[model samples]
Target chain A: MSETQQPRAEATVTLTNDVGLHARPAVRLTQTAAKFSSRIELALGNQSEWHDAKSVVKVMRLKAKQGSEVRFRAEGDDADAAIRSIVDLVERHFDG
Target chain B: MSDGTVAIGIVSHSPDVARGAAEMVRQMVGTSVDVGWTGGNADGGLGTDAAQILSVIEQIWTPAGVVMLVDLGGAEMNTEAAIEMLPADRQATVRIANAPIVEGAVTSGTMASTGADLEAVVAAAEEFGG
Candidate 1:
């Protein structure tokens, strides 16, 4: 869904780590996203295909390098928390 | 109540190797899983220790069982000995799969975290490769 049209909370963050969303960061993103009750999805660039935020393999497939922008959307009881946690992790570069 | 009981452990000859692989598995599987690992001998040299393997296993053991992924050679031998040291009941709950250490740990951890039974997790690890 478009950012403005999402039925739940959504947020966008730019990956800043030099390594981008590689193995380590991707793992952290998936782990943090999995903690919430929302059904979250992520998208990159102009691709409309959103991947399951909880799947490491799928997140890795995004190949979103540093400076790439990732959009996260979640719909559930805790959609807001899911968006905030994920945005926080991305902003923190997965605490690297 | 039938979910979230399985766990995985990784054994290698180098602590860094085990730690790196464990981190990857934890990332893919999420922190909800118990993906423990150990490497090298007690003296910190290049060798696998049965005691260390046993200790790692015990840390993540569950009634549903634990699956272990070993790097090879001494690691496999030490892991087998570690399992042998466990009591019969605990022994029955553990399984060592013939799978690549990194790939197997990632696969098993992912499967276990999703609520697959021990047998299914072991099968996924084994099936990960040819």
Candidate 2:
């Protein structure tokens, strides 16, 4: 079987912040995602459409309210690290 | 001199609003781009001041250019007046973004932090407009 290139890193995290993914958290998420070279995208729970995670506008538009499950996918050499960092950011409530 | 990235100017009718918005941008992007803000009338009342806006524009001016975000129609007019007061060369480099003050400031600042050019930064702010 021939190997096919695909995104190998994915994770889903719940937004636990009081305001969910509001402007402040959205900025943090986009900034964190921008640090990596990988292409990262996000989707709300059970939604098929994914938006660019590195765009503050797109991230803010997601409007993922508190307790909403947000999924992240990354494809590139640093995909795993990117996903890990994003997951960590979410888990930490984006305080950093 | 700027770091070659577009700068952001925030103008609001209330001084507190302008400062708060600028602080928000700073918290989001750190010092990645130059940010300046002015609000309220000369007497410290709730009104936009063209002179104050002009001063902020000059304070944060950069060769890359600057995108100004205004809170209301009056603020926009004052910002425009401020721009007109600048030298023709500077006026050419400054733009008033028709976007909400707080949202536009954040978006413009973030885009500028990535080294986006003036038009790109202005577009980012305008995208927030209804």
Candidate 3:
């Protein structure tokens, strides 16, 4: 996605990767999560608790399966840009 | 005393933990293996490594095939050649079907030492859900 098309508003995305959420991919996702000023939280499965995208262990605990919808939400000055990056990453399976 | 049964060997970076893990598996199964800490120590432990795999293959023999389990993938001695070098029966008899290496091995080894089968031990690691 282009910088201009970055999520202009706080947005949520569902991870569509076939492998579900994992470490190597999570590491890549977490790195992307940190790029924007907007804060990010990843909701795995149907759990009510939101986990910080920056925490590796927490992300691994999610154990998201293939087809599992993981939500990524960002809210802040660069929330749009941040969400765009996160979405792009999930789209590419974090380039795993 | 050996019972003409296949023997298990731990090929790891740390000799103590490797031997200990194998012994633990023995206690649980009542089938002790001759543990070999491949290229891991100066303490008179088995020193076969990836480079020495050919030489190591020349050493195993018996009614029970000698099994070599490693703690890592690319670096450890259980390369394709080593696996291929084992005598056909010994090769077939050997069981390296444990962990992927490092974390997988340590986790499985600890429990396998206590009698858990290779598969069960691997499952314990899966409990980590990675």
Candidate 4:
């Protein structure tokens, strides 16, 4: 796997906020995701499917509880920025 | 001004509801893009009026496009009527998204602020369901 050429970048971040990925945090995530040109998505721990990170409904639907691990993935010109933004927000407790 | 063309509007049954939803969108997208809203019936009741929606549409009209988010059944109907009432040229640039009012407003508004065209903003709002 390490020898393969990767077109996308992925990162995992823990939801430490009291409400996890609820309304406010979800909104923040979606808005930030929209700023980047890449196609970004979020997934639960070891989940095979990814949810659209630019939709609040999709983000909230994950119901990722506090302390749950959410993985972020992006592909396109701004993949790095997209992943960085999600990781920064999650690490900052979504600025709650 | 690359990302300053498109405008977003919100329409609901209650004036407060429309205002609050617009505020949520503004918080997410900032004040760069235009966001207009109108709510309530002609008599200030708990229903939507086509004229009210039309006025908001006209207020937010732009060369790029305008995306409208409506609250319920009445809003949907009246919004279609309002769009029909616009001049043919203006009508061509307007779209009513089939999305939850609040969520749609925020998502559409954010995308529009990013300089997305009318179709892309509508797509982002509809992406909420999938």
Q: What is the TM-score of chain A alone in each candidate?
A: 0.89, 0.93, 0.78, 0.89
Ranking of models by DockQ: 2, 4, 1, 3
Candidate 3 C-alpha lDDT tens digits along B14-120: 55666566554544223333334444544555443554543444454335444455665543545455666765665554555445443333333333333434444
Worst 10 residues of 1 chain B by lDDT: B107-116
What tens digits encode model 4's per-residue C-alpha lDDT throughout B1-82? 3535688888898989999999987776578678999998988888899998898899889888888888889988999999
Identify the runs in model 4 with alpha carbons over 4 angstroms from their true place: A1-7, B1-5
List model 2 lDDT by residue over B2-49, tens digit each. 449888999889989999999989988778788899988988799998
Q: How accurate is candidate 2 locally (lDDT)?
A: 0.88
Q: Compared with the true structure, what per-residue lDDT tens digits does model 3 show for residues A1-96?
A: 645443344445566776777655654665566556666787865667888775444666788877777777776778878878878887887773
lDDT of 2 by residue, A68-88 (tens): 999999998899999999999
Task: List pairs with backbone clashes in candidate 3.
Answer: A7-A80, B24-B113, B25-B113, B71-B102
Local distance difference test scores for all models: 0.82, 0.88, 0.54, 0.83
Interface RMSD of each: 4.5, 1.7, 14.2, 2.9
Please tell me which predicted candidate would have the highest DockQ against the true structure.
Answer: 2
Error of 2 at A62 (Å): 2.0
Error (Å) of candidate 1 at residue A65 is 0.6
Off by over 4 Å in 2: A1-8, A76-78, B1-3, B28-31
Candidate 3 C-alpha error for residue B55, in Å: 29
